[model samples]
Target: MTVKKILGAAAGALGLMWVVRAAWGIPSAIGASMSAIQPYASGAVSYRDRHFHNTEPGSQIVAGSARSLLYSALTRRNAGHPRGVIPLQTPVVPTEAADLAVTWYGHASALIEVDGYRILADPVWSDRVSPSAIIGPTRMHPVPSPLSDLPPVDAVIISHDHYDHLDKATIRSLVAAQTAPFLVPIGIGAHLRHWGVPEHRIVELDWGGSVSLAALGRTREGTDLVLTCTEARHFSGRGLVRNTTLWASWSIVGATRRAYFGGDTGYTKAFAEAGTALGPFDLTLLPIGAYDERWADVHMNPEEAVRAHADLCVGDPGHGLLVPIHWATFNLAFHGWSEPVHRMVEAARAAGTAVAVPVPGQRVDPNGLSPRDSWWEDVG
Candidate 1:
């Protein structure tokens, strides 16, 4: 072959390889930032052996076997996706914060309104919950509102560093669009910094730590809003490694009302402790999806979520409104698409827990919550 032909062929091969890599995900080790994580990670009491440990003894996040995983993936094909197009609603930003309101945007992303303050939790708006756009669990519905359209929030809380909970693209967009500080679990600031978020806007906290949002100014009734980092029985990581950063539930304490954001957790004794320490919450947002028997140690099923809510509400699951999150937007489990909500509603009814299953992007007021309507019944 001619020298020119050889050179052209080599160039073509390299270009094709680049396209393939982009279609797949960029390796987490190459794409994610790891610097400046040790100090923040080690500052937490739970940090040891270069990782953050869950308080639940003998609990382990089992990955199961590769053969089993593949079998489930192939055999449960029809069970993973919705039966029809999931209804999507346009999110409405209230003129003023309600006493305790929540706007669920699907799959663990929700906005909490308490004491005239707004807090956005686990705001993952990307199409896929992975490092790549072409792979991973894609969203079942479009984002209710664009990130640029999000109203000014007092704080953005990140529960963990998993790809589903923390998307690099969404973080970058939020950093550019919102002035609120990113309140994250320990070591998560490294990802924020790598995404070009300002250092001043990053607030890293360990379990039992608290931060007051006085910088956002007092509420209408002259009360300072506070957020406490609490315990969660879960693991965290975005790449091949695990538990490099802390995972947590958050307590948003307002003047007359409080809300509990249970990011993503399995059932644990810590929920009762959290209730004792930060109890009688006006509202509780808990995960009720993506759970399986194999990962029960790390993810709570619907019934466990109801029990967790009860534990967080001081033994009265009905004490506060329970609005289920972390479902309907993505297919990340082996159960049928609508199974989580069905199970959650059934369990809540049985336990007499006041539960509300809000459609994607619907804003709900806990004080005057409407009756449970199975909107997802027809969709999946």
Candidate 2:
């Protein structure tokens, strides 16, 4: 056998073994972010309890078929390449105020500033997003900012328990490095506790639920940073059992401005609902990556993301600058490395929506924004 093939087989075997262990013990690694349970915030849960999310649905990820593996292999997938970086002229940090800024570290990992508090969302700095160190979708590029370089954040929000979003080593590293509390959706806290995160450091919530974190940098004198768990149309699971816990997006309302963190999701009416109830957001961080025709309902395409922003507010869809995320950091799904952003930019233009597409690792203040050249066009 070829050396690469032998190594691939060995690595896959070991990874499968490790995944088996994680699945065997926990069965389903979805639940609250804290160590305890909390009632649903919107009075009732939005999703139905399904058996498919908890186990291998019909023996495959795509249900009754190996479509996930097949499509994943068919796509000319590549990791974050060095070809498409836009050089920094002045090297700006997006965090203008203590609040109202965002640094897209890669994929969905971002350090968001609002009102006067710093919140890290889905901070994955690890080399890979898989159960085994050797397998799964590895990061295409290095994390733009090292974990230590992260400023003192007030809270870290985890949207779900998927391995890509909810990495173990990354979580442990964040727990050791940042003295921030973990705000997660219902049942996700089980995995966090199992991974050794302290109980006091965990605050669990369900969809439409909100929690207030006070005294963070004290900008508005008497206000606290509020985090609200919002619904997303998607599925979750780390093992055989899926959706046993929960998946979500978050509404981070600071002292003055508010923003939405689009964790992995599909297209649903929830975005408009969230915007109506919790928006006209100052900024909306929505996903415009990893979408395919087969799963249109789960992930929003670039065009849909723009429409979502419009549905979120009363003014111009661009009233609140839209920053595109969930792409450019890692090679999760296949399409060209820059295709997601390129298409998104086109869609944004067609929709007459304003978008700030920053180079991975660069921060942007959607309010007082600067011009950014298209950097991803080179990757094919």
Candidate 3:
């Protein structure tokens, strides 16, 4: 064989061997090495390719453009990269003690406190959001809260099996630290179970299916909290195969308040289903970052987020306060780091929607929220 051909074959063989060893589970979470075994977990496992994205039977991926894998990648900008430096206003920390509160642990990770119960959503504490930590999109900023110091959470709600949302290392650490149950959508349990989490500790639900914690387990306040699995228009996968598991958003109804956690998805009418079935959330944690014209339909822009809140609340524009996530921490999309929030603010202002753009760790209430104008401008 030619020298280059021989080297390529050797590298491919090594990659195959790596996948076989890492698929079972990691030995430790403290410093778990990244692996290439991306697990596919979505409801549309049978038809997850481009056919599912079409609006109609044979419609185009976009209105008029042909879909190509290369073009489908999220937008990227070379001019306004963060220069590998971001500063916090003052080491902001998320609060755990509140009747209704949310602490953004940078990106999509949040500590949600409602009705005296704590629920964590899409907690990605890893440094990178990809199958291999050595490659893929690394975080531009540090996590707000340390994993070891996290307060006891009632439940950990995973939206999907994406590396960013359902991190294996973080999940392993969480299982060791807290005595909470994991609430995930259908098929995600396979991934959690594979990660060495106890079967009894996991509660998996499908769209509109509900799991009542008080009925199944106990909480600090001795009050029952309901987590309803809501639908989202998104695809999921981890390894060479995709969509073998389910993906979903979540609606958390605690004793005193109601909150919605939209993990990661494109724009879809499914939000209306969640509203009709679950409805009128006090706070909606929506994805408003990593959006572009190329993938805007699947991912809502900021204004679309406002629209989604309205739809989730049955067309009431200002029914709930919008807290934005899925941005600021990772370099997943090519827009300027803060572009999503900026556009969202402009859209929210014109639409009369309430929004609180909290610093990564800052806590916020659905009511009596503060408006921080131009917070991300400094970072950009």
Candidate 4:
């Protein structure tokens, strides 16, 4: 064959190899098959008619048709992206987890410290939040810190089975790097099991279920950190099959301090219910992004997040520190990249709530928080 023909053939082979590799990752990325997940999910109160239902009656997408949503997503691809480079901070992880501190790792990933126990929540370190690595909402900024750099955590908690929140690659990496148990919502353990996570490492819970950190055999002596799977008005699915698993918020209660992680959810009265049952939290890491009127039933807008924070704080709006999550890391919605924080701050101020807007990887001790700054204004 001539030189040009040989070159073309070699290029074609390389392209074919790349395609094959990408395709191979898709199945695992989509996580446990519906059949594999059913047994673990079937018994939950939320599970009926072969799918999980939200406590409140609502659709994930309320205002727009799928085709219209798709068209807008395609046309306004850059609408959610930041105008400037997203600033990142290298986290300064202490030798011991603090009594009440949290390190925001962008998107929905956060490492929360409550009463000297570290809990990593909804950690998604992958480049894209889609089943296909090459085609999805790619991270606008690189992970602020590598997963290998994380301290030995008491538990790794997942709020749902969505790709952005419950990543397969990150779970696999954690399985190899950390000895912590995986605390996930019902049916999520099947995905963990499918990802080769040892059965001993998986602990599945339905809403209102509680597991002691000591019971998991990972906590320090006399530590009484109880992780409760609290209610969240959200849906879950990694692929075409939706809500095969339960979606939830998490309440981390220590002997003295408490924290609530509203992984991803719409506004729901369940926030008050959680506060009554497991909260009056000292710190709340709630989602304040990926919201749109079209999908408002599933995602909370900035103002709703403020309201949720107060509700989680047992109706005392100024009770605790509120650090925003689920924004600034990915262009998942059509709003301006900085809009969530801006609106969140305004609503928080109006409600007498204390708020902390940390840059990715910046750790905040809710006890000794600094004055709020407009770091996002310069970035976007």
Candidate 5:
């Protein structure tokens, strides 16, 4: 064939490939639309004008202009990639649960073992967190445990519908692997329903709403797990439109121990309210990563995570074990890969807070919490 003919064929093939890749991502990207979630969204007290709103006014995100967003996107201020392989722990099946324990499975995915019942939080097991499998943020480390490896959990708690937290691929796998109900923030069930999760297995709630294990437990013992959907200072959207679904933190209360899962949030007064109403917790898993100056009001920095931990644990900073999440997995912001945990340790010491920086898949028991070894120092 002539050179011109070969070039024409190559261009045509590339164009076709682009079209195919875009088409493959469209379904997952355009998740549940406003129309599909309207009924549930309208019922939420925080929802207004066909969207959910954060109670805090003057959020940097809402005030941010398109030009500022463009600028931030163009800037790469930090080396967000880790220098060495992230160490992983082999997760073991616990024959019985501890009074309060947490297994960090990298990023926001964790197994909170409290009072003999297990609750998995934001369990994203996919290799990449994106609408398209070929693009977006890929995992820095292999998943410590496969979905099939997970023991039966009493409940699965989802904090929001962000691609990183509320993963479609992970949800579908959990639907088949475990018998637990998915306790998600309001309107998130719409996305679950769209992706073919059974309606009976989904328990959607607005902020301050709850589900007791007696109602959702698969066992005859009917575990004492109480999951409350609490407020978070973040926005949500899988596609162009945002906040059709609510974002939230969670209060996971068992019979004798309680834990708080800060799915994702900025510093907010709501943490104080949650502490006053439902806390003095045994453990608190707070997000301490993916924070940028451009969206500081949406995602909490490591220092803020320490502060929030203090607020939620009733000012007794040393009371609960604070395990940092939303970091070490995906490079979502312009901060050195290990910066979050390092800053968190510094701030925690100043605040007299007790923290357990668990390696991905390492289990942490708050009652006899082990000393933090600064594992990320070498890896970073």
Candidate 6:
């Protein structure tokens, strides 16, 4: 073929690829729209002005010059990524759930075991946490394990509807791989329904609402496991319009043990309130990344995570095993890759808080907690 014809054919192929990529999975990935989600969200007390509002007014982004922000975005594309390969561990899933343990599956995804019941929290096994697979913040490290590798869970807990925490692809996989019901904040069930998740598998709850494992027909030795939808200081959206659904933290209560999963949030007094109402948690998995001065109201830094842990422990910092989540998996902010864990370790040390910094996919049993190791330093 002539060079001109070859070039023309190549260009045509490129155009077709771009179109196919953009159209594939984008619409479904955006989840339920505002009108579709309203019926589920409107009755909640936090719903107002056609959107869900935080108890304490919070800003997603603080005022700043657009030009400078744009410049920084363009210039510091690699600011949040690590300098070396992020190490991964093959998850050690036991034949039966432990009394109290957690498996960090990167980002906000974790498997929590309490009182012999296995609960999966925010399991996003997708490579990209965005509506479009061709674009957006890709995973810094590959998912430690595939969805198929996970054992049958008693329940699945989702904190919010953000892409990172509530993924369409992962939810679809979970529906097929496991029979666990998804207990989520109000209106997130709409998204699940939109994605073809059966109604029986979706449980929606407002802040302070809860459901028991026995009620869901999953019981262990006749012991009940309670999952509560607690408050969080964050916003939720899958597209341009925001907060059509509620965002939240989760309180996992078993017969003899309690744990808190702070999916993603900034500092909030609600932590103290949760501690008083349903805490004195034995294990706390909290966010300690994706924080910036511009959006300080929504994302907590390491110090704030430590404070949140303390608050959940009812001001007793030395109470529980604090496991840092929301970092080391994806690049979603402007801070250094390992900055959050470094600061968290320092804060925990000063506050006398017990912390476990696990590599992606590593499991931690609060009963037999190990000393902290600087596993992330070489990678970052």
Every model's Cα RMSD, please?
Answer: 3.1, 5.9, 5.9, 2.2, 1.9, 1.7
The reply for model 1, stretches above 4 Å from the true place, is 1-32, 58-66, 215-221, 369-371
Instruction: For residues 1-380, write the lDDT of model 2, one tens digit per residue.
Output: 99999999999999998877645423222323321432232233543443213111212134534666576666555533436543322223534345588877778888888886788898787786666555567666677766777777779998887877888777888889888889987777777877789988888787788888863332345668778988877777676555556778999887679888888877667777888888888878888988766566677788888887776654457667788888766666656667777787888788788888776677887666534667666543
Q: How well is each residue in 144-167 modelled by candidate 6, as lDDT tens digits?
A: 888899999999999888889999
Position 58, candidate 6: lDDT: 71
The runs of at least 3 residues in candidate 2 whose Cα sits more than 4 Å from the true structure, single-residue gaps closed, are 1-44, 47-72, 75-97, 215-220
Which parts of model 3 have CA positions greater than 4 angstroms off?
1-80, 89-96, 369-371
What is candidate 5's lDDT per residue for 1-380, written digit by digit as tens?
99999999999999999879856956865578788999877768898899899999546464636676666568853468899999998986678877789898999999998888889999898888888868788989999978898888888999988889988888998998888899999899999999889999999998899878887645436557778999999988888788889999999887788899999899899998999889988789999999877688899999999999989988888887899999999988878999999999999999999899989989998677564899899999
Deviation (Å) of 123 in candidate 1: 0.4
- Ten-residue stretch with the least lDDT total in model 6: 63-72
| Minimal lDDT window, size 10, model 3 | 29-38
* Per-candidate total of colliding backbone pairs: 0, 21, 15, 0, 0, 0
Question: For model 5, which pairs clash?
Answer: none
RMSD of 5: 1.9
- Model 3 agreement with the true structure over 1-380: per-residue lDDT tens digits: 99999999999999987776544333332121122112322344333432123221221135655444345443334423565456543233344456677878877899887787889899888897765645567777777657887877888999977788888879889989989999987667767777788989988776678888887766665677888987777766666444556678999887677889998888778887788877788788999987767566667788788889888887887887888989888766657777788888888888888889987777786655565666677777
Cα error of candidate 2 at position 167, Å: 1.4
Global lDDT of each candidate: 0.85, 0.71, 0.73, 0.90, 0.87, 0.91
The candidate with the higher lDDT, 2 or 5, is 5
How do the residues 39-140 of candidate 4 rate in per-residue lDDT, one tens digit apiece?
888889888999999989888887447888888878886888988989899998999888999999999999999998999999999999888867778999
Candidate 1 local lDDT, 111-219, one digit each (tens): 9998898999999888988776666788889998888888888899999888889888888888888888999988998878777889999998889989999864434
By TM-score, who's the top model here? 6
Residue 7 CA displacement from its true place in model 4, Å = 11
Model 5: CA > 4 A from native: 60-78, 217-223, 369-371
Give the runs in model 4 whose Cα sits over 4 Å from its true position.
1-21
Model 2 lDDT, full chain set? 0.71
